[model samples]
Target: MKLETIDQVAVIGSGTMGSQIAMVCAIAGYRVVLNDIEESSLEKAKESLEGHMERWIKKERLTEQQVAEAFGRIVYSTFLNDLKDSDLVIEAVVEKLDVKRDIFEKLDQLLPEHAILATNSSTIVSSKIADATFRPVKVCNIHFFNPALVMELVEVVQGPHTSDETAQTAFQFVESIGKLPVLLKKEISGFVANRILGKLMDEALFLYENGYASHEEIDLVVTKALKHPIGPFALMDLTGLDVNYYVRQQRYEESGNEADRPAKTVEEKVNKGELGRKTGKGFYSYT
Candidate 1:
């Protein structure tokens, strides 16, 4: 499958990453289908995307006509079968391996043989993800940073059986959408960004749990002192404490080391249903 010639794209799981990816593709002149299990969530996602476009129009970044065209290019669906004609798919489903594996397996069965199956997984390796699916050669990781519509950098991780041509095509596709594409020679856990952030989060967890500083204090030091756009606490709140904790826990177990263990506090907050912005509270209050 040629990247430039790709006619249709599908974004599975219309949450933060999926919806934004669909918007980016639509804006880039590709017909996109954004699929989720729930119809209500799909409606909510369209509203959210419209709001995102409203901001762009307000800033003169996107004209009203452009906004209408972008929204018109997107098709929302509640089933995987809606992606039958899609030439490429970006799965931004839950971080759970089983959930991802099931989704890839279904796509493999339904999609064309040449379709590129990419995962937006931050930490999990693509090879393992491919092992669970039948389309190993077609599977690769196109890990986009948060705010996929704005973040310019994208990491393309190659699985063990991934064809060289497929990897190159992914880079071309990223460039088509005005994203910076960095290629990994091979697959690695976390791709790149999260691998770097994971270490900082580890140390930050120790500090917060050991009483070195409060969450607000920690956030202030990083964002104000280090000039980071956001600190770990703020990031956790934005990313959802439950989601962040799950990634950390998985990475820790994959590392097979006590040092990589997730912080007790992070886990406790998640267990209590304080899942950051989604729940209105985590380390900080959202409302």
Candidate 2:
């Protein structure tokens, strides 16, 4: 189907990335269905979207009328069957292969034949989940950066079974929503950004663990010397330590490499339920 044919979009999970993605589609004038099994999470998504709209209005990035219209276009639902008419379904659920595969299988059975299935996973590739559905040609990875409403760069990854037309259509869809789209020629574990980020994080952890410097010092050096926007530890806190831990665990499970395991500090934080900004504590205290 052509990009113009996509009128209804659905985002599953309603978490940080999912909710922001739904709002982004809504602002772009598409009917959006933001789905989550829990009503509390859906309420949180609605509150987050309202806060984003209010901030944009105050900054003059969006008018009050535009925000109102966008809000009106979004529908919250707990039923996966509600996505039956969605022209595009983006899965932003937990970063687990089995869970993602199950969701894809269900979505494939529910959505129209022409509906495109996309995953917003940072590490898991579409190839790993595409086989779970019969419409492998319609499945591809459309990885959006964290804070989806603000981040401009999106990676559209083509799996082994994904059709060329599907990748092109997904790329066009990303552009249609006012985001920069980069094509991944082949499917890889972390796509592009996360792979590079993984290396940086590994080195940063090594430095802190080996007594080269404290995390704070390392972050200061990266920010002041390299002119990076945020230090590695601070970024981890924003992204969630629990998320980093799970991604690393998945990588280790896939490769069976000890080096791919999560850092000790990350594990420690997750064990304590510090889980970064969401929990108000991680490498740094948000409170």
For this target, which candidate reaches the highest lDDT against the unseen true structure?
Answer: 2
Our model 1 lands, by Cα RMSD against the true structure, at: 1.3
Residue pairs clashing, model 2:
none
The residue-by-residue lDDT of candidate 1 on 1-287, one tens digit each, is 67766889999988877899999999999999999999988998898898899999999999999989989999999978999999999999877888888888888889888899999888777787787767788789998888887889999987778889889999899999889999997777877788788778877888988999988898899999989999988888877787787787787778888766668988899889998876898888877
Residue range 15-83, candidate 2, lDDT tens digits: 888999999999999999999999999999899889988999999999999999999999999999889
Residue 29, model 2: Cα distance from true site in angstroms: 0.6
Candidate 1 Cα deviation (angstroms), residue 136: 1.2
What lDDT would each prediction earn against the true structure? 0.86, 0.93
Please give the lDDT score at residue 138 for candidate 1.
Answer: 79
Each candidate: RMSD to true structure?
1.3, 0.9
What TM-score do all the candidates reach, one by one? Answer: 0.96, 0.98
